[model samples]
Target: MFAFFTRSIAAKLLVVTGVAIGLVLFLSNLVLISQTRDRVHALTMEQADAEAKSIAREVAGDIGELASAARTMAGVIGRGHEGQSFDRQGITNILKANLEQNPFAFGSWMAEEPGAIDGRKDDVKGQADLGANDDGIFTPYWSKDRNGAIQFSTFGAKYDAEWYALAAKSGKGAITAPYLAEGTDVPTTMSSIAYPVFSGGKMIGVSGVDISLLSLSDKLKALKPFETGRVLLVAQGQQWLVAPTDELLMKPYEEAGADALKTALSSGTGNLVPNLADANGEGFDRLLFPFAVPGVNTTWAVIIDIPHAAINAPVEAQTLMMIVGGLIVLGAVMMALFLAVRSIAQRPLHGLVGDVERMTKGDYASDVSNQDRQDEIGLVAKALDGFRHKLAESNMLAAEADAQRKAAEGERRRNEEERNQSASVQQHVVTALGSGLAQLSQGNLTYRIADEFPGE
Candidate 1:
């Protein structure tokens, strides 16, 4: 195989073309894969961003609905308080109806200022029937039990819940951080919101509604990013309203195994952080989107965790498929090039070789083929054909020279025979002349004239 490849022009050229094509494909595919990986990564990131925004928008809308309902409750309280006194039964009926009408409203309450109800501050102070505490403040809180029955309760301490004062302080509305609502049958986590009631330019009372995080958490917990990670509902970056599990609910990011999230949390709203580790040191990216709560005049954020592996897995699979396809194309192209070289180059070269072989055996009668071709094979054939002509001409000249040498030898032999015969006759004539001279020391001329007398 090695010898064949070395000797065959078609094989050499096919190998070269195959190598060149393979190299080009390798380089191009390298670039393509790099670009494709980057593009895929960018697209996935975009998808995650869009997903987060969508979730934030939906969560914001939900909070907005609760805020709207709270506003309606506050409006009713404001209108009733404008008349000078709190109608106990009427206010109780209103709070009850608000909770009943809006299924999402977990609880509703009205907290009043001391002496603000009918000038009876000390008289009804600490009276259980009037729902007043030691400070002569009346705060009636209405809520639901596990069976969904309306329950009556009174908030005794003036500062038991901060949402009460915050609402009055803000003079608009207030929202609480995620907190565990005690004394509830279901024992769910919830947020409190309140709107201040103004009567005659003085702060008369505060009307508020409690919203449950149970359904919201359930909604968020089911939403897994990349189907591998969970979403978190974080409030003001300080509290967790919803988490992947109940154990993480209402816990601060620090205690929730996210001590590394301090920088991102302090970075405030609208910040997206990547490459952070959870409490378990698991790496992931977090997209923090602050969505406004409807009644609170504040925004809470949603965080979606994205694992790096999930993003890379699909990209790697796609890249592998692309490389496989590219290799298949390369193989096909190389095969085509091999076939073309065989047809266009190898066959002609074979004919030229046979011609050379015939010439080597001294059979120069046939002209070399492919001499008129425009390729390297043609050039080789033309040169060999020229050599053949020269050798044949040299062989013809040798034959002519051999014939002339034979003719010259024949002529020389005839001249030698004629000389020998002439020499013998002259000797014979001389001897006869000598003998005649002896006999005729007197008439030797006549003896010589008998030997050869033509000239004489």
Candidate 2:
């Protein structure tokens, strides 16, 4: 193929045309694909931002209910419904109603400081004495069973649980960072919102609700913006809570590199991360959309990672279309070039060949019509025409010389015949004279002189 392309003019021309067309197509496709990819990335980022915000709002609404419910119940305890002491039965009803109202709240508790509700020590009923190491704080916990039944439990005042201690000291409602809560049928992750109870300027204990995070994990798993895209909840310090699966839970999110996640968390906006690699050494260029869940103290962010291939599919399709169109145009140009070269170059050369053949046969009268065309073929025709004229002139001079020689030969022959006749006449006259002389000598000269004369 290389040799044929090197040797043949049409092949060379076609190759050149193809190469030019390919270069043009390549550049055009690059520009088009680049523009298309930009547009897609922008649009996808917008959509992802919207989705992240929507999910953020849902999470806020779900977990925010804990704080709201805890504060509402604490206000109830502070302002007694009966205008007397705090109603234990009423508080229990409120906790049951809160658990039933919000599906995300798995448990509710009201833990009081020692002697805050009743100063008498023995007034407390159903209290299980742990040991002499107790801190004397009383906590009443109400939780719903998996089958929707309300169950009661108690915690010691000196339990020293972080959520209770923080809420008790802060004297206000506060949400805890997500943590795995024990004592469930199945171990589950949860967060609690604790609101300190106060009655008449006196500090009481804390009232709060536990919001289960299992649903958040389920929501994250169900989310799929693209075929390979996923949503992850990155808590403070890059801890993964609600990721794709349980194995990914509580793992460090920075294994995929922390720069993009840090940017998203700090900026609280959508960002496009270039060529991010995963833990297993598989790299995927992704986009990050991070939004903070409202009403939470933890610096948590929701992030969405979209694969770059999802954004480039349309650009690739458009580039393929450009290549196909370029190929069609190249084919058309090649056909036109081949036809033009054949007509302008090959046909005239074939006519010159015919002229040479005729000249070889000694026939030079025919004129070459293309001699005045002003191209290389015309130059050849003109030179052939000059050779034909020269040959014709030489033939004409040869014919004239032959005619002159024949004429000279005929004149010489005529002169020679005349001389011969004259000689014959002279000979006859001499013979007559001789005969006359002989007759005279013999006495008979008058007989031949009168009848035979030289002029006759």
TM-score leader: 1
Among the numbered candidates, top lDDT falls to 1
Q: Which ranges of candidate 1 are over 4 A from the true structure?
A: 1-5, 84-86, 118-137, 147-150, 158-160, 255-269, 277-283, 402-456
| Every model's TM-score | 0.80, 0.72
lDDT of 2 by residue, 331-426 (tens): 787788778767876577778878888878878789975897898879889988998889878877888999999999999999999999999888
Q: In model 2, which residue pairs have backbone atoms overlapping below 3 Å?
A: 137-157, 439-444
lDDT (tens digit, per residue) of candidate 1 on 1-456: 999898777778878887888888889878887887788768767887788789988887767777777888777776777874547667777887888887777888888876664566677666756666566677777888888888877766455476777888878887988888875666888988888877777887778888888878878888878877778877874678887568878887654335434444455446557786766877777766666666687767777788776667877887788789888988898788878887878788789889989988989899999988898888998999999999889888988999999999999999999999888778887887677778677665455435553252
The Cα error of candidate 1 at residue 414, in Å, is 9.7
Residue 448 local lDDT, model 2: 54
